[model samples]
Target: MAKVEQEAEVRYANADGLADALRGADALFVWDFLSTAVPDAWHAADRLRWLHIASAGVDPVLFPELRSSDVVLTNSRGVFDTPIAEYVLGVILAFAKDLMRSYDLQREKRWQHRETERLGGKRALVVGTGPIGRAIATTLRAAGMEVSGAGRSYRANDAHFGTVYPTDELSEHVGSADYVIAIAPLTEQTSGMFDRHVFRAMKNGARFINVGRGELAVTGDLIEALDTGQLGGAALDVFDNEPLPADSPLWTMPHVLVSPHMSGDVVGWRDSLVEIFVDNFTRWAAGEPLRNVVDKDLGYVPTGTSRV
Candidate 1:
């Protein structure tokens, strides 16, 4: 890497100091996970030729001005795939074995044994057939679970997923699923896409998992689905509101599990991201086409939300 060091100007560790380096930089790398502090800083400036965000989702950087610009954009897509797939596998197994129930039973000092479900033969509908989705399917299948992948378009006979359904057919497949996992991107069409109508359509006692954007699901409606017995269980790592209000009732919901959106994070997250940006940086410096370029119109259309 040092051989190409001279070709590189400055790589901002994050968006904080990114704007300051732009005047002397040919390309800028902004790994700002907290927010798109740089995109907002240089919206009207012409110095920024390309902007790279370290997050898998680019909604933070997709301001109207940046969207209308010719600046090249990219994201860290495959960096967190393995860890997130592992998280999903853990949740699937936990829910299937009623791990939470066993923990509660232990608290009561009960010595009762109960029949529990296995993931061996159950089917799962993994929405958004992107890198993260495909990784999840592969891991789930390895654990003996049948998988179905849903996406915007259907191709002939996809081997990874037992069934491939068009995006519009999502609700139909969801109705019969043992597990409906939302890993879809947050776009105009997907925003608030999972509401009362969609939840009420799922099979009785089926699990609904959302590692995607909070805007995709209605939080209050999710509570209603569980309360009404329409949904068996729900595990959410994201919420419409971050650092969820301390007073919200979701914290006390009986069948609901809430995570502060930490599913994709693991040891070495920052270094791993730095490595990916370094590789892509090399390509950008050489005038070669960059990978994982985000389509602003699609709004983070590339991969699933791994920072669940």
Candidate 2:
């Protein structure tokens, strides 16, 4: 508020009063990235010109009305890239060193020792060639792992990504990877892309990690893969359903690690989000092009574009 204090008036609204609040509002800052209220309240947005979401993926706000409207939609993309990349590396190291087992043994007062897998020479098949995915691949490579990326199209020997295979080639690489990571956006083509066929194609004992949208993979198929030993384990940060229903078997699975969709969040993340919004808000108010403006039709910021 301090940055735009002189130019704009800020109004607060929760889900219950959102529709009414949207009336005559020229700009909206959706602090609750997960809220579905924006779409429902969109009808009341008589003066809305710009809508800013404080998150990377804009799936939650890509309702048909907003998609067809002139309202400028923006997201906080670059802020979470490095933090999420670091999270992926931390989890990969934890799995390789069997840190979970060490903690379990400590709790039982058993001083047992075991051999761990070497990260070097391991292969990682990273889906999604966006900034976040690229960051993950770079970090994994720095840690001595061989990484290959898959995206909407194939590129040969790009500067950041040596070779990015098209999505069609993903199945071919699944069976050869020690780690299969999904970080793609939630889109028509990507929804449920990881199913029985893809899971069955994975190398036996190979681990799976999803820092992307949950709907990208079929939960039931993943469970079956782990149950049948087709997959060694899974580290899931997102799920088909948020909060992952208490009775979901994944919570108790010995080989599975479940987190509440927080891979990209680090200390002071909320403040960072606010900062991004404030900067964009300043631009919006001045009738200048905004940062992180999403390609509404594509559902994300276009590649090779400046984010901030």
RMSD of 1: 3.4
Best by TM-score: 2
Score candidate 2 by lDDT. 0.88
- Model 1 TM-score is 0.89
Please provide, for model 1 over 215-300, each residue's C-alpha lDDT reduced to its tens digit, 9 standing for 90 to 100: 78887888899988888888888888887789877787776778888778899988877777777777777888787888888876
**lDDT per residue, candidate 2, 1-308, as tens digits?**
68876788778899989988889999899988888899888889999988999888888999999999999888998888998899899888889999999999999999997999999999998888888998999999999999988889988886656878787667776788899999988888888888889989889999999999889899999899999989998999999899899999999887788999999999999999999989988788788889988989988899988576
TM-score, one value per model: 0.89, 0.97
Ten-residue stretch with the least lDDT total in model 1: 299-308
Evaluate residue 304 in candidate 1 and report its C-alpha lDDT on the 0 to 100 scale: 35
Model 1 alpha-carbon drift over 4 Å, by segment: 1-7, 11-25, 34-36, 301-308
Question: Which residues of candidate 2, in runs, are more than 4 Å off?
Answer: none
